[model samples]
Target: MKFLKIGDRNLLYPIIQGGMGVGISLSSLAAHVAGNGGMGIISTAQIGFREDDFYKNPIVANLRAIKTELQKARDLAAKVFENSKLTAKFLDILKNYTPFIGFNIMVATNKYADYVIEAVKAGADIIISGAGLPIELPELVEKGMAVSGNEKRTCIAPIVSSRKSAKVILKMWDRKYKTTADAVVIEGPLAGGHLGFSYDELNELGADTMTSRNYKKDKYDAEIKEIIEEVRIYEEKFGKKIPVFVAGGIYTKEDIAHVMDLGADGVQMGTRFVTTYECDAPDDYKQTYIDAKEEDIVITKSPVGMPGRAIRNDFMDRLKSGPIPIRHCHNCLALSVCDRKTIPYCITDALCSAANSDESHALLFCGSNAYRADKLEHVEDIMLELTEDMN
Candidate 1:
């Protein structure tokens, strides 16, 4: 397969394993993908929820775990190389030319910029910020890099949903920070978790949140094409190629090929990876996807004031009935004041429960094609299947 170059780093496989948070994608999944030549991203959303003192002090726990997770990915990658029968020359090439570890920090998180700064200082090779337009991302990266005292460039990318968003971010960064993005992830409305589109827009496409499934190709494809074209304009301005990756509903080799045909440099997939053996989520959590049906995947309201796609379950049914009580603030979002009274439920607690495999009570987030997952498979096998035709 042809390689993808993001800044100074050359990825052997153009695919990026999307970051799933709470406790879904961690060192095990990220390291395995990186070891196999794909960019692996560890999600920083509630990353420290597993720490013993997390409830007492969530920020400190998340910061400490961020450093620990990145280091663990590096350690695991080194072990993979040392134990392999591949020649040292090729191993050395990989070690020098590629970055195996990265962090996924949502722009909507509590102390969003702080997380980016801390993650960079903790040795993240790349920072993928999403869930909102990361306008100040470039400035934070500049400061973070300076603090790290590392001469090497740490790649910064933003996850965008529309051409307007892409243009706005690129223009702002160029005018203010005098910098351009290293990469861009174009996420469509069909993506799992919090969607980029509003409820009305999503409904206008006949997206039956309760039952029928549909993919409005014309609407999404046009947006993606426009964004890619906008990126090309910046590429010409900077006299450098900036890679664009398409995400959302990408489940098979055909899906990847289709997007590449649309001028995408690569793809970022999160849901497919969740059912992999290496995914950090509990077995029952993986089982949720495997057991789901087309009708089970529904559009729901996120506590963060955004719409999300999730599996229809008893917990969700109860939430629909009335607002569930918020026992304590999880300190998940970067807001001056959290209006728990207005929100339906606590996202952090729900996701954490899902990660722990609490099927009856947890909110199960999934991709549009999650119902297609029949069983758990190895990360290596999934990667090969996705890239077999490309190679």
Candidate 2:
């Protein structure tokens, strides 16, 4: 595959492991992917769920975990280079390589700006924000840079699903910050977790069915083209190339080639990575994806006020009957969007349950091709398979 250039770093393969939440993609997964030459990302959503004081002081715990996780990922990547049995080619790749470690912080989270600042201060190479339009991301990033006093400017990227969202974010950043995005991740309808598209739009796009593959190629390709064209306008104004990566429903080497041929600089995949041995999720969680069927994948409502794709389970079935009683608020999402009194259920609890391997009542988020996984694999092997056919 072609190298994915972001600022000064050239990722060996134009592939990014999409960040999964609540305990899924952490130090282990991120480190392995980065070591293998892909941009590895850790999800900062309730990252400290295992901490003793998480429920009592969620913000403090998460902020502390941010530093810990990033350090752990770097350390893990370093250990790979220390191995005595490394191949000559692997040794060559490590000779001058610095693992590209990043964090995915949702814009809808409570204290969104705080999380951004914490991630930057903790020395994240890049921060990818989504779950809402990151309108003030540039401002937050600048603030973080100032607070950290770090020599290297932390790169920022916003996740957008359509040309309109892309245009709005880029124009706002240009007008306000006199800058454009370092990169852009275009997430489509078939993505896991909280999707940007409306429920109606996703339904019309046929995001959940086997036919969605054809839909992505024939119909979604137009949307991808439009967004790339919009980004090109800002690229010219800023006099730099802003790489665009496409996420959702990207499973194989062919998927990577198709999106690249359609103008995407790279591909971001989440579901396929969950089955990797190095992924932070429990074995049961990974098995959920392996055991899932085409019919088991469904779209459900999220407390973040967006539609999410997940595997159908007892939890989802119960939600269909009525609003589940929320025992306590984790205060995870912004109060403006997720009011404790009005929301259906506590998203933090559900996702945390999934992370802890309580699959019966957990929110099992997965991409459209989640059912395609049949066995656990290694990150290095998966990375090779995805880029073997590319130049």
Candidate 3:
């Protein structure tokens, strides 16, 4: 496999382990991917809650969790830092083992602006933000983080739904931000969690009307190709080869081969990593993916004003029948455009429950192929499987 570079640093494997939230891909998995020659990304979405004190203040839960997760990532990184096994004495030496440590910060999350800054301080090399138009990302990346006691390059990678989104950011960067994008991710309908489609567009695409859940189709959809084509147009206009990565429903080596054949620089996987040994999600969470049936994975609408794909379970069945439960509201009022009361369940409760392995009420975000996951394997083995026969 060919190594890829982010500015001056080198990543031995262009492969990027997708960031999963609420304790899915934690330091263990991220460190392993980086250790095994790939770009490992730690999702900063709910990082801090791993701490015992994460939930004392209900409103600042995400903030507390971010702090906890960053520390946990460092703690779990002990093995990767061992002198007997490729030790990284300086913080920058961490670049060699897992050079491209990234953070997936959702623009939709509460306190998102502050969260982005925290990721940089935690030594994130790439900041990939999605769930909405992250117009302020360039400004965040420019804030800079310290490594080797000096400011390091922080790459901002935005997830785009269409060419229009790509063009808008590029124009904004050129005209207003005075910065060019370091990279971008083209996420499709098959991805886990949120989508970029509209009500009518999704309806025409066969989305269920009463509920916001999505379904699976046998063949590749045309919308994804359109998104990729749009991304390419922006790459051409920018006059810079901004690395384009793709995600969603990537299940096997054949799937990886196909995307590579289509000209994507790399692929990102969230569901696949969830089953790996290093994944920080609870064993039951991992088991859910292992034992799931093909038809069990479904999409649902989040009170957070987003359409998400997840496993069909009792929690959702309960949502449609009764008044949506609300034990507490963070009221962080993170997004100016969002209405906080519209949020159904405290994402904090449901996700943390699932992370703790209580599947009865936890919100499970999964890709269409999550049910097709037959076994749990090491992250490196999956990497070997995908790249073994690569040309």
Best by lDDT: 2
The best-first sequence of candidates by lDDT reads 2, 1, 3
Clashing pairs in 2: none
TM-scores of all candidate predictions against the true structure:
0.95, 0.95, 0.85
Error of 1 at 249 (Å): 0.3
| Per-candidate local distance difference test | 0.84, 0.86, 0.69
Deviation in angstroms for 269 in model 2?
0.4
Which model is ahead, 2 or 3, in terms of TM-score?
Answer: 2
How many clashes in each structure?
0, 0, 9
Q: Candidate 1 — what's its lDDT?
A: 0.84
User: For residues 130-154, could you state the per-residue lDDT of candidate 1 as single tens digits?
Assistant: 8877899888877888999877667
Candidate 2 structure lDDT: 0.86
- Of the two candidates 1 and 2, the one with more favorable lDDT, higher being better, is 2
Q: What's the candidate order when arranged by decreasing TM-score?
A: 2, 1, 3
Clashes of 3: 9
RMSD vs true structure, all candidates: 2.2, 2.0, 4.5
